[model samples]
Target: MQRELIDGVPVLWAETPGPLEATLVFGCGVRDETFRTLGVTHLVEHLAMSTLPRLHFDHNASVDLALTQFTCTGRPEQVADFLERVCSALCALPLERIEREAGVLEAEGSGVADPTTAELLSIRYGTAGVGLASFGGPGPDRIPVEAVQDTVARFFHAQNAALVLTGAPPAGLRLPLPAGERPARATGQPVRQAGPAWQQAQVPGPGLALSCDLNDQAVFLAVQLLRQRLTEAVRHREGLTYDVGGDVVFVAPGRGERTICMEAREGQEQRVTELLWQEALRLATEEAPEAELAEEVEAAREVLLDPRAVEYELMEAAAELVLGDAPMRGRARLDLIEKLTPARLREAFAAALGSALLVVPCDIEVRPRRADGTELPQFSCGQGGELPTVGESSARP
Candidate 1:
């Protein structure tokens, strides 16, 4: 991987020796906006890429909590052309299509009910910053053209962006963006409460959800080990769930969120919750096996060495840069993973117990209580609606 500066924007290039694929990653995303203008960045993304459908290259745009990206795969020249056109389109966004795009956003929003992470975030961090994911962004109709333009000028600039190419540098690619400073990371507005709390939600099936603070490398390894243990107990042994896994999500600098989730069979919600806690307790007390840790490390190495990994890593680095974080290279990450000792992982698991949050079936009368025997908090619906019962379809918290 090589890093260069073109027109004052950082560009990361890797010669993967395959068909050309490139992505223009910007520092702006849902995290950059306020509750009043929540979906504005996404709206801008849609309008900016509206012209791509008419082009020959395969291309798309995505807006996540912390970044927006435009990606394309094609011949080098074709990819260059696509990116150039996108940069130009961003420079002068089509404000006339604001209403049209707003309709599109509304339609899109309707299809997606609240997601589990969004609900968790809302519970963890109120209805602003990261919590806006649960609240839904400001209505498109309320966002003005000037607001969109200002956001574009502030975030979609040379200093706040990076261009990553997988095959080779696209010839004659120009990022004609105006000068601007990198945008600051979003500061989440956390709810005024301590956790190790429990919450419940109504959904079609039973499931177990867990969240913990991402404090260090040990916490990350602990999350992975927890997922393995949960899968074994819930899916393989008890046959209570069909899906069981966990993921560590990047929230901000020196902070992350880990989630362990499982989908359960009908009438198995309470059992699944109990089993999950049992595993959690075991993990907290017992050390992870050396064999298991080695196996997981090898699996991670395989993923990092995969052909597609660099592209993903490059985009991740771009997002980290925007958040004022120095990205860890692949070698550094592997070294950390290699040094993960059973004792260190156990300590991390112990610390995770302090701030754990669990979500279970709302209708289940006997929910899993915290280890400390305290009452768990219930997450209310933002729309002033009643929580879903077991038989009804549940919306995200």
Candidate 2:
């Protein structure tokens, strides 16, 4: 892998011997938009790619809390052409179809009440920054053409962007970007809360959700280990849950949230929550066995070594660069994982549990409360009732 500047835009090129894959990643997404202007970046993304001619390749665009990415995979020439077309479309977005695009966005937003990430973040951080996921995209009709165009010019630029290629750089792949500086990282105004707090979500069946501030690789490994334990105890041993897993959401540099979830059987919500917390507390008290840690380390190393992982790392590196942080190389990451001891991981797990927030099924009354005996906050929306005001009864200490 090599880094260079192409037309003033940072580019990370990897000459891997595999199918060609290229992504144009920018430092703009949900975090860049305000509450009133929410979904502007997504709207722009939709408009920017609307004009691309169909090519025999896999191409798509996605928006997250802090990054927007356009990716294509196919023959080198095909990938290169698609990327160029995407850049051109971004530079000259067609606003004439604003109404049509707005309708499309509204339809997309109407299907789901709220994304799980958004719900969890709203409970932990509130409806700002990463928490805005709880707030559906501002309808296309509400966003002005000028705001969309201005966002494009400010964030989708040469300086705030990176091009990643899995094979070789494409010939004549010029990124026609306007001059602009990278926007600053978006910050979340997290709601103040004490830990082991519980919230409710409207969903079929029951599940247990947990969130904690991400500190380091040790915490990451701890989460992975905890997930494995929960799966074994909840799904295999007890047959109480059918699916149990977790994911990490990075809100900003050195700040992230990890969620562990379990989908429970009917009438088993209380048991599932109990088992989930049992696993967390066990991990906090006892160190993970050396063999279990080794297995996780090996699995992680395999993923990092895979050729396809380069594409993921490329985007991650670009996001890290935009956030003013250096991306950890694969070897360095493995080294950190390798050196992680059971005692260290236990400490990390305990710390995570100290600040963790738990979300359970809404129908189940007499649910688990916070460890400190504080009342657990409930997340109510249009379906549940009126939304709670900030720092209201739903807010925890």
lDDT digits (tens) for residues 169-191 of candidate 1 = 77687888778976766556467
Model 1 pairs in collision: none
Cα error of candidate 2 at position 168, Å = 1.8
Q: TM-score of model 1 relative to the true fold? A: 0.87
Candidate 2's residue-wise lDDT over 311-388, tens digit each? 677777877777665657777777888899999989987877766677766777645544455665554443457766
Provide the clashing-pair count of each candidate structure: 0, 0
User: How far is 225's C-alpha from truth in model 1 (Å)?
Assistant: 1.4
Could you list the CA RMSD of all candidates, in the order they appear?
7.4, 5.8
> What TM-score do all the candidates reach, one by one?
0.87, 0.86
The per-model lDDT (C-alpha) reads: 0.73, 0.74
Instruction: After superposing candidate 1 on the true structure, give the runs of residues whose Cα lies further than 4 Å from its correct spot.
Output: 110-114, 202-215, 367-397
- Could you tell me how far off, in angstroms, the CA of residue 131 lies in candidate 1 after the best superposition? 1.2
